[model samples]
Target: MEINVIEKIENPLLNRTEIHFDCTYQGEATPKVLDVKNRLVATLNVDKNLLVVHNLKPSYGEGKANGYAKLYDSEENLNKIEMDHVVMKNKEATKEEKEEAE
Candidate 1:
């Protein structure tokens, strides 16, 4: 899969960066969110816990998908703005938070 980003925004008040990318995604069962999260982490050299994959989708029959994501300054800020379901879907971060608190 290849990602071509078309938009990027940094919101200081939110303490996050918003990004939109167009991607050629082939794996049907793969969660694009995970891929996007990884890409953003590598690109920004930031912790995965601070990233949120908002949505990634394509129109029916199209292999190319549009994706949106945000990179937060910290896990707390991430939880503050992201939806509950989104936070739950990313089990990795939740587990990390638990380990950190222990």
Candidate 2:
């Protein structure tokens, strides 16, 4: 899965910026919020003002199928990023797997 920032929004109350990503899944099963457990890799602006988070540790909410990601700042405030379900490839194969098959 590769995530690319599509947009960003600044929150007045939290004083943090939330980045929306164009999430794409090339795995077998559709990428769900549950699958993001400890697998989230913040590629862009991680060290800057924006702090990306996943699975809201300590209180893993009801394992919803369509749960989005969140962001925070140095103060530990939270901001929500609305994620939309995009195109997914069901029969994609990995490089190692393809090599072994051949």
Candidate 3:
């Protein structure tokens, strides 16, 4: 899969940077949400804990998807501004992590 960042906007009021991106996978299925989040963390050089994937929508009848993500200045701000389900969607929880969360 190839990811292209379409736009980035700094939201000072929210203490975060919002990103819009497109992912292209010529012959592959639409990537998983966690997979896309990991790629964004690596490509943007941001802490995974402070980044959240809000949504990723695959284009109809195409191997392309558009997504939105946010990079927060701190974990505090991230937790405060983002919805619980969205943050959880971006997390890659192992057995231990799942136990800890419970």
Candidate 4:
């Protein structure tokens, strides 16, 4: 699977960064991970140490459904797994500081 970051927006109310990305499944006629002409939203909250992601638009077409994955950086390693949300936190950190830390 291949993914690319498309756009991003900072949400002050949520104190998180919302990232939109274009994902493509590179294989032989495999199902897509997301719907076409729709955007996927991933929220990264470092202050709360959480990452929440969801499909902004659900797939309406027939066939296999799209998939989503949550990734995290822990213990100096990157872990990719299935999850609904992710959380992390550290002292002496501001929301702006945390976003820059990413």
| Segments in model 4 whose C-alpha atoms lie over 4 Å from true places | 28-49, 56-102
Q: Residue by residue across 1-102, what tens digits does model 1's lDDT show?
A: 677768889999999889887777675644457776787678667788877778888756666778887878888888878889997665465677879989
Candidate with the greatest TM-score versus the true structure? 3
Per-model CA lDDT versus the true structure: 0.76, 0.42, 0.91, 0.38
Candidate 1 C-alpha RMSD relative to the actual structure: 4.9
Error of model 2, residue 77, in angstroms: 2.7
> All candidates' TM-scores?
0.74, 0.41, 0.90, 0.36
The residue pairs in collision within model 2 are none
* Model 3 CA deviation exceeding 4 Å by range: 97-102
Question: Which wins on TM-score, candidate 1 or candidate 3?
Answer: 3
| Residue-pair clashes per candidate | 0, 0, 0, 3
* Model 1 residue-pair collision total: 0
Q: Estimate the overall C-alpha local distance difference test score of candidate 4.
A: 0.38
lDDT of 1 at 54: 81
**What does the lDDT read for residue 17 in candidate 3?**
94
Residue-by-residue lDDT tens digits, candidate 4, 1-102: 344666666655444455565455543344333322222322232322233344433334432234333333332222233232332211234799879999
Off by over 4 Å in 2: 32-41, 45-68, 79-102
Candidate 3's displacement at residue 8, Å, is: 0.5
Q: TM-score for candidate 3, please give it.
A: 0.90
Better of 3 and 4 by TM-score: 3
